[model samples]
Target: MKQTWFERAIFFSWYCGIRDCAYCFMSTQPDSKKAVRSKESLLAELLLCKKLGWKIGFISGGIGAFSQTKFKDLLKDMYKVSGEKFWLNIGALTADELKEYLPYTKGVVGSIETVNERIHDKICPSKPMEPYFEMFEDVSKLGLKNAMTIILGLGETIKDFAELKNIVEKYNITKVHFYGLNPQKGTVFEKSDPPSAEYQAEWIKKTREEFPKIDIQCGIWVDRVDRVAKLLKAGANSISKFPILKKFGSKEAKEIERQAKLAGREFRGTLTKLPEIDWDGEISKLDLAEELKEKIKNKLRLYLKKMQKNYF
Candidate 1:
């Protein structure tokens, strides 16, 4: 099979300080021992990603360790190597930290999973919802792109989704990651049942109606072609965890693109754009090297061609 370019990059966080979130997929917790990775190791991984032609997508972890000197040093080292290719997914950052990082960071992930304070407090006991929003506000003030994730089936309702829309509008959030809550064994929500894929399709539809201009990614939980078709029909334009890349050619990637076209949406290969925001204009504004800018422009051109081909 012919090789293809990967749309986005996803990096793992070696340390997570906020481990107690009820629905944490990684099962990180406050008392859990942190397994820190060396700065050299992370930088090497970033280099590998670049070699593979993957765009800086998003890096996730319990970034609370960044508050400590060691993790901060590791991040700085990684930044030197990563440049603006990767977006940071760790939250609880201060204004000064955000400013210091603004030049090196492409974007930040402010994951306010739910708007219900009571449920939020009950589920994520250590991580307060207020500070997260405040951080998001700070991020917005700085003109940095931001994205958030909303986990469904955590006892939220349509009203909660409405509030999320308000947050996106207020913060100028560029993208939204929607996923269903899958109970992990031994976790606080282990007994909880996940919402049916059908329910998530409805939620995606509602979110699309609310934020037509913002990109919605329903790929977190969708794995099958039928589910991909349903999500795209419901208004999701992109997916995560997809194996589409310029490396190993996956038929699934092409099929999803075909399905997206059939549903009247364009599958802009992963990470070609910022995951959190509509970065069409922002990329042009960045002070990137000319060579990098050309590469980005080419990707945008290709994306436009794909979408235009469907219409013509």
Candidate 2:
């Protein structure tokens, strides 16, 4: 399918220092922070993005936000591939690191997840992410343009949205992404079901109503956003779908352009109609690349399974 043009496209690649994210999609136990992207693999991804005319970048790749070794390698590769222009949405960075990275970034996002410390640690037990909140202050204080993603339904209450709204008010975040907890087949929290689409949208709607400043966006359920588009009308700047995360080619991505167009009509006059998103088509055209990534992941899993079997 031919793709429609978007103002820009965000090409994402993810890694984990914690092997498994606090709420990860992979079935295996979490890995350690020491692993960095291999040059061969990183270059392959960049090469693919280059083929698709995508302005390449990286995100949610472990503790690289603190400006650590693996992150440094990731940054070096991104710059190396995209040259002077690239956008990064790395997860959980610190204020101190932002000072160093803000210049290199067209934009940076430290998805603070949830601001409540007790709850934050309870979910993300492998790492103490409370310190990462400092980056929000730095992003706002420095007037750095950035984005923030807040995960919902990973065991959070309505009060969590209120607290998150307050914290973001202090930052100059360009966008706020409300991601529904994806409890895929494996992971420590796999048994948990995400909150209902209605409930999730309502919470996001209420939060935006109370704090009607930034562009409030939703991920996963585009239809839900259409429903809550009224309360969110005054506040919502965009509607985004994460059709692809660590993986690519989701039915959701291809539908965004139509979804955005439809949602814009639904809340007509209340919201701005952003251009269509060509995310899925982008991946489909890059079929060879997507297949290669699947091959690599399968190999990696097979290798790891062997290693585990040997150790056991």
Candidate 3:
């Protein structure tokens, strides 16, 4: 039998690291803190992706709603090559901004690491949860579907996770993932312990029961089968890994795959894609999410009307 190529639709996935979240693996590298992967390097990586016939993936330290484009000049260049199949991590934004960028997005990811304001503030200082309002506001109006996430082990309470569930339920978030906080060596919380596999496993089960209507996932690294096996048993469908970029067919990457096997998880040298946080949902609801859409449209329509009348 022949081996399968990741060129198939679901297999081609990538992570475009664009967030202001406290936990970013690339930031832990030897140098270049707060680094944004260059378009030049990204373009080169895409070239390799194109050659390998494998799905493309991109991961970065910080991007999206939390930070401005590192290189606006490269947008056309990236689009000319990468086209529509890309995923981005959204940190934060407002309703108006979501409307402005809605047309260009394939999808979004609101990395609301924690729903609690104080814990959120501590994990990511100088950042707030205001972007979620815009995200909810826009996705409702524009008819966008997005993924949502909650990062565990940042000192959040059960109440915080419950609030996360309520937010997704209220907004109709299509895909929901829960991630364990991986402390980078130099970050303020570097000494913190990641949630134990057993703890993660238990939470996965509990979260599944709590949000029975939506799909749930845990970080792919923690324990692909264990952390989420019960969730799967509890009727969850989607699952994922932390999305590190080991070079295609590299020995080190292959060895990592071997480790996954030992943990009862497996990878097939396939590409994984990550999407940007739903900027459109954060901006406008051209898609008709009923209540939230009307709220945002009233604001936008008003803005347009004011423009027509030169209210400014």
Against the true structure, whose lDDT is highest? 1
Off by over 4 Å in 1: 1-9, 25-31, 38-55, 67-85, 222-225, 242-312
Off by over 4 Å in 3: 1-35, 47-76, 157-159, 210-217, 220-244, 247-312
TM-score of 1: 0.70
lDDT (Cα, tens digit) per residue for candidate 2, span 34-90: 444554355444543453343332344444423455555556655554455444566
- Shift of residue 109 alpha carbon in model 1, Å: 1.5
Encode model 3's per-residue lDDT on 1-312: one tens digit a residue. Answer: 212122211121123243334665543444433434433345444433443344432222244312344333343344444454443344454555555555445445676777888777865654556666567667667676666667778887665567776777777776666667777776656899887666555666666677665655545452243444343443334345533333233343344344444444433443332223342343342332356444443453443333233111
Query: Residue-wise lDDT of candidate 1 within 128-178, one digit each (tens)?
Result: 867767888888888787787778888887777768877888878887777
lDDT (CA) per prediction: 0.62, 0.51, 0.49
lDDT of 3: 0.49
Q: Identify the superior model by lDDT, candidate 1 or candidate 2.
A: 1
Alpha carbon RMSD to native, model 1? 9.5
RMSD of each: 9.5, 9.9, 15.4
